[model samples]
Target chain A: MNVFVVGVGLIGGSFAIDIKAAFNEAKIYGVDRSEDNLEEALSLGLIDYISNLDELDKADVVIIAIPVDATVEILPTILDKIDDNCLVFDAGSTKKKLCSTVEHHDKRRNYLAVHPIAGTEFSGPQAAIANLYRGKTNIICEVEKTAFKLQEKGMEIFSRLGMRIRYMDPSSHDKHIAYVSHLSHISSFMLGKTVIEKEKNERDIFDMAGSGFASTVRLAKSSPAMWAPIFKHNKENIIETLEEYIANLAQFKELIENDDFLAVYREMEDTNHIKTILKGIA
Target chain B: MNVFVVGVGLIGGSFAIDIKAAFNEAKIYGVDRSEDNLEEALSLGLIDYISNLDELDKADVVIIAIPVDATVEILPTILDKIDDNCLVFDAGSTKKKLCSTVEHHDKRRNYLAVHPIAGTEFSGPQAAIANLYRGKTNIICEVEKTAFKLQEKGMEIFSRLGMRIRYMDPSSHDKHIAYVSHLSHISSFMLGKTVIEKEKNERDIFDMAGSGFASTVRLAKSSPAMWAPIFKHNKENIIETLEEYIANLAQFKELIENDDFLAVYREMEDTNHIKTILKGIA
Candidate 1:
């Protein structure tokens, strides 16, 4: 099997690594706009060859792992180039836009839209690591849109990589993910911005920040190139969530200002149920 | 050496564990308003004996690890009950108010204002773990007000626990901590609240939430009893940070609403320097 992984950064590089390790016949080819990333992916042994979209016809599997905006731009072209038997999928964060981009394409059956819920605060091919998808949730959007055989092929790969699959429509995926994923990024980024602006003394943040602060702001280190497009593509849903988030913050702030300690305590106590909601999630 | 641990919860119990292991002659006496906590601490071997406030004069070292408001109410009495040679320190989140509460106490020389920047989202004696303070920062406020001998004793205990010391005035410590610690908690709690309210289906949060979402909401699981008083005591500083944070979020939301993707990208890119600032922090 020949795997063509475009945008050979963290997600793409990681998928290549796992596929190469899981299948003896899998030969990985890297395609990235950044020549430096392609070179680094090669040097890091994340790919067997550096190829371009022109050679995508030879691919048994094509994984689109670029920014969501870029995915929307090139997905139709990618679907046009792959063989009928080829299974093409994307690992973008926002699904509705990417799925809609190729809904009327001639080879719509060849493409699968997926958002694998896994990542760290780092980016680039160097940030890629093995077993990233192990025990992680992979949400598949519009599974009925893909060819049955291609869907089976995608499932086989996800199975080998230890991903649990949940099928949802593209619109619901985008809306729900706005709360669970995109909103988290914006909140983290703004939190980091607020702290960095207020505490000009970096040494103070260094000394005073505990594990809680680190955990809450960890996603601020995510790649802007990847996240900006996501925020843009899922604009309406994300804006809704940000509005809700800001309103919640403002209310909580008001409670504290009015010296309503009981209300503040109840607010946090009510949210403590998040522990049970997040139980068993990686 | 006799150690009286008031409020035998996560912080106090962990301190007892380390103190017991570090000094062979040290005896840990648990004092909690809740009998269940004292009983649990005894079963966990976090304390050698169960005692009361009246017996505090027998204490050679007193560790106050309760809520900030409770700490303010009882600090003076604890100082009065301790021997002149005894060392008393707190592990509260806010320092200015706590320091001010015992400012003019007759036994002020025996008290040391310290905030050990270490804790998990969980609480109670069952959440206690050994070595929680290893390689963590312990902020000391108004060290000069502490008696020379008692300061030496407190320093010895901190060294044994492998804690690095930082000295700041009470006001500055409270102000800086609001941005780093207190503000992070409110953001996380509000994020959790927003998501929980918007996504009524808990299964969706469980299935769709990723590592990033999990991390950004981790602090929302913190004990409400412990945090409400902290928000009250540090109201001004925390409200200031929240205003900045909410303003940043609102502006970012405006950028998204207007399709200003470039500004969103630049905003995240600029804050990426938090990576370097937070380098080496656990």
Candidate 2:
């Protein structure tokens, strides 16, 4: 099998490594605008060769793993260039825009819209790790729109990567992701911003931050190039979540300010159900 | 030496384990208001035996690892009952009020105002681990108020647990911690609450949450019994930090709402410096 991965950064680079491990005979090609990322991906052994869109004719599989805006802009073009037998898919965080772009294309069955639901705060080819998708969820949207053989092949790849698959519509995927993934990034980024602005002494922050603070703020380090587009693409759902989150913070703040310890205690105890909820995540 | 841990939960139970490991000959006693916790600590081998406030006369070292409000209420009484040569210390999160309560005590020299900056969301004797404090920070407030020999013994205990010590005044400690520690907890709890309220399907939350969401909401699972008191005692500083955080979130929301992707991108880019700040924490 011949595979081409677009935007050879964290997601694409990791996919290249894992897919090669799963299918040793498969030849992998890297495509990215950044020469540095291409070089890094090559040195890291994440790809078999560096290739371009002109070579799409030879690819049996083409995975789009770029920032969502870039995916929105270039997905239709990639679909137009790929061979009919090629099974093209995306690992973008948001799915609605990409699904809509290729909805009416002649080779629509060749394209599958997937949100692999995995990543780290770090980016770039250097951050790529093998088995990044292992034991993670892969949400496949509009699965019925794809051809049966291609869907079967995609499922085989997901299983080879050790992922559990779930199916949803593109609209539902966007809504749930806003609450579960995108809102988390915004909360963490704002948290880091608030602390850095208030606590000017970085030394104090370093000395006082326990593993709790580190875990809560870890997503603040995620790439803005990636997340800004996700937030923008899913703006309506994200805005609703952000407003609810802000309101919750305000209520908690009011309780604390009024010295209503009982109310504060009850609120936290109510939220403690998250313990049971998160146990399933791991 | 004889050591008594006043509250044998996460902090106290873990301390009992480490202190016993370091001082093999030391006799460790467990004291808590809950009989269930006492029994669990005994079964876990976290303490030599169950002891009470009356046993204070025999303890050469007394460690108060309770909620800050409980620490404030019970500290002076524990100080009044302990032997003159006993070295008493606390591992509470807040320091300002605890420092003020014992400011004029005749046995003030016997007390060490210490906050070993370590913990997880889980609590109770079952959560206790052998080296929870290893390679973590210990913030000692008003170290000058402690007598010389007792301070030496306290430092020795901290060293055995593999901690790096930093000294600060009690007021400064509470102020800085409000931003770094307390505020993180609030953000996490509220994030969890908002998601649970919005996402009615537990299965969807389980399926959709990536590691980032898990990390950001981890502290929502913390013991409300332990945290409520900390928030109540440090209400002033926490309220200030919460307001600032809310304002920051509102501004970010406005930027997103206005479709100003550039401003949203810039804000997250600025906060990305936290990646460097967190490197020094570990």
- TM for candidate 1 is 0.99
> Which residue pairs of candidate 1 clash?
none
Model 2: per-residue lDDT, tens digit, A135-207?
9999999999999999998998999999999999999999889999998999999999999987765566568
How much is the lDDT of residue B163 in candidate 2?
A: 97
* Ten contiguous residues minimizing lDDT sum, candidate 1 chain A: A198-207
RMSD of 1: 1.0
DockQ comparisons of all candidates to the true complex? 0.89, 0.85
Name the lDDT value of residue A151 in candidate 1: 97
The DockQ for candidate 1, computed on C-alphas, is 0.89
- Per-residue lDDT for A170-269 in model 1, tens only? 9999899999988999999999999888777556556888888889999999999999999989999998999999999999999988999999999999
B155-198: candidate 1 lDDT, tens digit per residue: 99999999999999999998899988998999999999999998
